[model samples]
Target: MENTTTLGCLVLLCIFITFPRTKGACRFRRFGIDCRYSCNCPGGCNDVNGVCRGPCYPGWHSGNGTVCQTKNIAYNGSTKQSSNYYTFKYLSNKAVDGNRDQNIYDGSCSHTGLNKTSASWQVNIEPPTQIYQVKMYYRQDLRKRFRRFTLYLNDVDEEWRVCYHHQKDSIQSIVNVNCNITTKTKALFVYNERGTPETSGQSYERHAYMELCEVEVYVCSKGTYGDCRQFCYCKDGPCDFITGQCPGSGLCENGFTGQHCQTDCSSIGKYGVNCSESCSASHCFNRQMCHRVTGRCLDGCQDGWIEPTCVKHTQVVPCHLSVKVNSDATELCIRSL
Candidate 1:
């Protein structure tokens, strides 16, 4: 009998080893029942599902990692600059009015005073966002005026960080600069100072000017990536706005778990970090009444269970009867300690 049992176990092990489950031949960024869906996220997708396996690309919402929407956050911000060419025209807000007419006189581009030693244009973004990219549209006819410029980002701390610096004298009409680091910032700046070339010996004879036609700031929502549709519960601060990469562990809310915090703890009668605590111990009236975050019973504990946490059994203590006589009243009470 022992020999037969050992042989049966060996045969089952051999069969399991011979036919291991496979994820199939889906290529990177491809998923779905038949591996026919293409993911918008660069990180690809799980072999069995079309959801994004990683962060979605900027401007693409991570709704299953396949929705695309380009949102320009700068359009709603207030704009300002050091100086303007004319009081009635070339206002700073012109650069963010959702226009790219390129013609400065048409009230579309923002122009700083010529011969100024320093010039700057800035926008205060409403509802500070996690920004990743900035797009600048310069005057098409005078592209050289936008050369040797620096892009800056200011966070809630009011500290300015350099996003990009143009070192060349020749620039294109439209330039896109990647901040490289995603940040929860509130302001964007275009600054230029005369006589200081980004690279030594570069052109510095011309005074600085901020003649910008339009500025578009691209951002992913806080704690989200791609079209800013997914939620990422990072243990530390916010995750990378464009990549969905957390600075710390992939932590979830008390009632949630999984790499993206998508799985609810109640699914497994568990709660708390990683769903390691069992809800069954809560002694709730109904198993679903246990609070996932606090482990407290919502509808009250069952008979013989304690209040609040309901985890402990009620301790029955002996009660002593006490009698008191007053001038006009008699009282009897039972107390337990």
Candidate 2:
């Protein structure tokens, strides 16, 4: 009886170890999944019920589920420079009155009336380094005269030491100014200074109406300190100075077409490099692929022949022999020879 009781107790212990009671089983209330052990949450820890938790890092924002995206800030008002930058215009005169020319340089001596006033705009910028460049487009009217204008960096107090002044009749000048800022600056100010009073009794008022057509500020990377050539390379794309790839779509200017866009059709097949020579029927009798670089055919064909390839030929063919007509006053005689 004692041996049977011990055997029964052993059997009960084995059953309990193999198949435990289902009560108190840890159930993942959020995912609707049950586990024998404590639920080790996957991915991010569940902060609240039915939702995962994560944070967007710097320069990026959390967009919906588990996705981070870079924030796109407007550079220019309406003009789009690229996916990264924008180009916008800041006019001196917003009233649309003809008193102010849109292209005139602001804060210049020659700008008359209310057009002489100067304005500044702010932009959010990101640079790879502390040194950057600012580009401005300016033009003066033929009658206007200007001495110098001051460009302020970041604030009206911190101004560029160099004064940009142009003589009369200097129209449409593009100026690139380099700036180094120790502190973060988001605003730029432009000041106009008139040199002397005009003969009309009105002060020149610096007739310098300035227009900010486009401004590009890029941070310089290492090994490119004070080197304009290095500045040319630190563009949006990889530098290809030999091909001038930084400005355009990796293509050369003019009517050229190629990878580097260096080949000009007008400059090919000419006396030297210009396309001047005209191919004649004797040189290129049949339809042939004329050498673009040279006005000559690779192969020549017979007079009545079409092409060396002969993929297709003209249906009309001229006979080799012709009929001879005999000279007669009344009767006419003709024979094929």
Candidate 2 lDDT by residue in tens digits, 1-337: 9999999999879856644432233345222111222112243323222122454322222323432212222133222111111122233322112122334344321122333433233343333123245544444343233224455554334434332334443334455666545444344444554433553236355334433333444332221123312212222343332223444454333323344333433234221133234333323443333333333343444443344322222333235444342332122234446
Q: State the lDDT of candidate 1 residue by residue for 195-295, as single tens digits.
A: 64554245554477888898988765455565455555555766666766667655665666776664556656777777788878777887665555566
Per-residue error at 195 for model 2, in Å?
Answer: 7.4
Candidates' TM-scores?
Answer: 0.51, 0.28
- Residue 309 of model 1 has an lDDT of 73
Instruction: Estimate candidate 2's alpha-carbon lDDT, on a 0 to 1 scale.
Output: 0.35
Question: Where does the lowest 10-residue lDDT sum fall in candidate 2?
Answer: 78-87
lDDT of each: 0.70, 0.35
